[model samples]
Target: MTNHLEGVYQIHHIFSNINYRFQQLINSSSLRLKIIYCANISNEILRFNKEQIYSLSLNESFSINLIDSLFIYLESLRITSINSNELLLFISNFQSLPCLKSLTIKLLQCDINHSQIYYEIFSLKMLKYFKLSIDDYSTSLQSSSFNPNKQMSHLEYFIIDYQCFLPSITNILSYMPSIHYVSLMKLFYYRSSLETNYPSIWPNLTHLSICLTTWDTMFECFEVLISKIGSKLKFFSFKNYHRNIDYFNASRWENLILKFMPQLDKFYLKYTENVDRILRDRDNNEETNDFTRSFWIERKWILEIEINNQNILFSILPYKKQWFNEENLFKLNQLVISRININKYNYFIQDDINRVLNFTQIYHLEITNENLFIGLLLQITNCLFELRSLKIHSLLLEDDSRDLNLKEISILYSIHLTSQIKKIYLRNLTNIKQIDFLMKFSPYLSFFKIDYLHNLDIPSILRQINHTYLNSLCFYVPTAD
Candidate 1:
């Protein structure tokens, strides 16, 4: 059993007695184990000294004392099953990690005290990513005004998983001027909480997704919210559950998009069975609804709309070309062309890579399968020397044809010999044996969209990595019907 555990990376399902033998086992395993998915644990765990751990999804048993010892340099942390007060205390007390960037807190409850909760979040100056999820038993109304003026410069993406009233959402947005994406799992409002006089705005917000569960009219609520969104807004999504309003006028949405969101590219609308009719009618009127059919035809101004069953999507063609000029090109740090349409070849992206080769400062690059991305990588290696984030879709190690092999994988690694990519996203790679091969690069990757991970794979992948301060890990296994 000991020999079999030699290169293991995870110490999971562990509930044990702490003896000298356990101490030896821990010391032997400490060098490789970089992650802990702990269960019932005790203070004795402090004796293990799993030094390389950079990410922890800890339980309540790993209380404040254990936390103080373990949280020193962790880049990502998810505290499972804790109450709001405990979360606030932990965050407030956490005064010194200069590198902690991504944080996920799963609270068993919440408080309406917005200032206290938010102050701790904004206080983490280097934190760019944040996710807060509340348990089902949570009862906070979140009605109080969060009069916020402080600017959180590093805050970029914020996701709050609670049924919150709009004032809290709007107020929170007002404080996070640098935020790009805002996702609210659910939305609720009391009649009194809707203050007509309060003026708030998220100046840099680009994407917004919200869930609505109410029978009351949302038009007035939407109008107030939309008025605050100045032109940088691009995507807006509404997911209606438990209730459906009289069908929203298509013209109303279009007019709102035209007037308030000049740069809007896409929007989503979803609801229940009144949703049933919307789906069918949307399909029948697909072409007319599409914001535009061709970029050249409507290059000046016009949006394309399409329906994917229940989803009504609007596409804005050439909306990004205005950035092809010298001034805006400097601002193009993130480029995402990772979506692979099964039906068509991604030749357009190949052209884009060549066209943007003159651009020398892009920090993030997202590419799809090699049929669209292989050559682009070679071109990018020459131009973008400061690349920090690389997201690739459908990264398969094996294909029927003989274009790539282990040697090719090494060549791909050579391309990044000069760049330090901090975040990586890859999906749909079915070759199981290559997981170990990929593990060799785990030390270099701060974030991974490992959608095909299995339980047995964690130990080995984590074993060799002395995780960096920028580390974050995400696992996804596609659900079976």
Candidate 2:
């Protein structure tokens, strides 16, 4: 699925003698390392609880000859405890990494003037994605601070946070002419009286993700921010910790998105249980979960605002729709839902469900969650007439006594629509006794992979089933930690 990855090699600093061995092996390969992280490579005092830095000695005048050795072919690199006293010396070797596109830098402590630091960062022409976790909010970057000679035209994504709020951030962004994606970790840290008249600053920005401190401050620069950057944006996502649903003006927000972002997508809106009042009816406890949608769908393409406590990604797949035909809609074959958030009986509207139900070409389906399979699983099994490979992920059960839900057990009987089902992967699933219930759906099912097999009676259950059709059966017991 990914063409960018060629090979991955990681050297963890787990032992005393691994460092010398790592250097010896690194020189053996001529191929460039796309990603490299020498975890805890520094011998400095671990004052902060950040990821341990693994490099050379903590002496004041240490040789960075080792960094030059491995960094010659690195595309992505991470370094820790870079000398705060002599910051420029630490980054002098950065020019050697001509192919370096991504860098994550964390410093122990320092108060280097923001001008020099900002200049150094902008000078990296090839660097695209940079995470400035330096925790220094002070900035001397203004409208004129950017050097015309030092232009980062290739930079696309940046992760930067400043406590002074949007004014400071806006000052920095005014210089970056080609960045398409930016993660403003703190968009509203404090109120700013500074006004931004520059609209061209965010002209090329297509993907914008902001972590708002509160919705109260969201409306402060709401109109200005959206009016400037929203029109060209393809993807927009914002998440805050507050529990207020009133802050999100759905109609106004919809209009803004409609007017600004025309190239939207069909991604699901995933939210956690904390804001249940807005999406789920708390009072209504019926057989079906009363789920409300915050997204929109029209002509098979969807524009959505997703919220999740788990992992959230802000990405947009660009396609020319004018040259595309209607037949491309049915080309989907793989459907995967990681972190199953939907509970039983949770369903969408008739039209909404049709979008998913009509994906008849889907064969590889996957679902993973800590507990309770989504209600859509039943709908999928009942509707997907051609499902072949089914995979389910669940947490390890507390004890072997607990049994799978009755609704879960009944899926074997409802999988008649998927007559071509050949393989099944139940990964990290608890209660192996449930394997006995598969006698009904075992006729055409040949390959079975079951992980974390806690119960001892799984062998006896498989023996009961006639192995004439079952070609592969793998039962793995998890090694004790």
Predicted structure with the largest lDDT when compared to the true one: 1
Q: Write the per-residue lDDT of candidate 1 for residues 1-481, one digit (tens) a residue.
A: 8755853423332323346566677666444334555544533454455344566667654555445544455677677787777777788655566557788888777754756777788878888888888776357546666654555547888887877777767777667767889888777744554464434445678988777654574566666666666477787776666444332344455667767878866666643332234444343343333332233233233232222333333232333442112122223345444332222322122323332322123556666544334433444434556666665665444334334445445656674465565566655444455444444433365565566654535566555345554356676755679
TM-score for all models, in order of appearance: 0.50, 0.51
Pairs of colliding residues, candidate 1: 9-459, 10-459, 290-304, 290-305, 291-303, 291-304, 291-305, 292-303, 292-304
lDDT of 2: 0.50
In each prediction, how many residue pairs overlap at the backbone (N, C-alpha, C within less than 3 A)? 9, 9
What does candidate 2's lDDT look like per residue over 118-182, in tens digits?
Answer: 67777777888876655443331122333436354466887765332565566667778887888
RMSD of 2: 12.5
Q: In TM-score terms, which candidate is top?
A: 2
lDDT of 1: 0.55
Off by over 4 Å in 2: 1-76, 83-85, 92-100, 135-154, 161-164, 189-194, 246-252, 266-295, 299-481
Candidate 2 worst ten-residue window by lDDT: 283-292
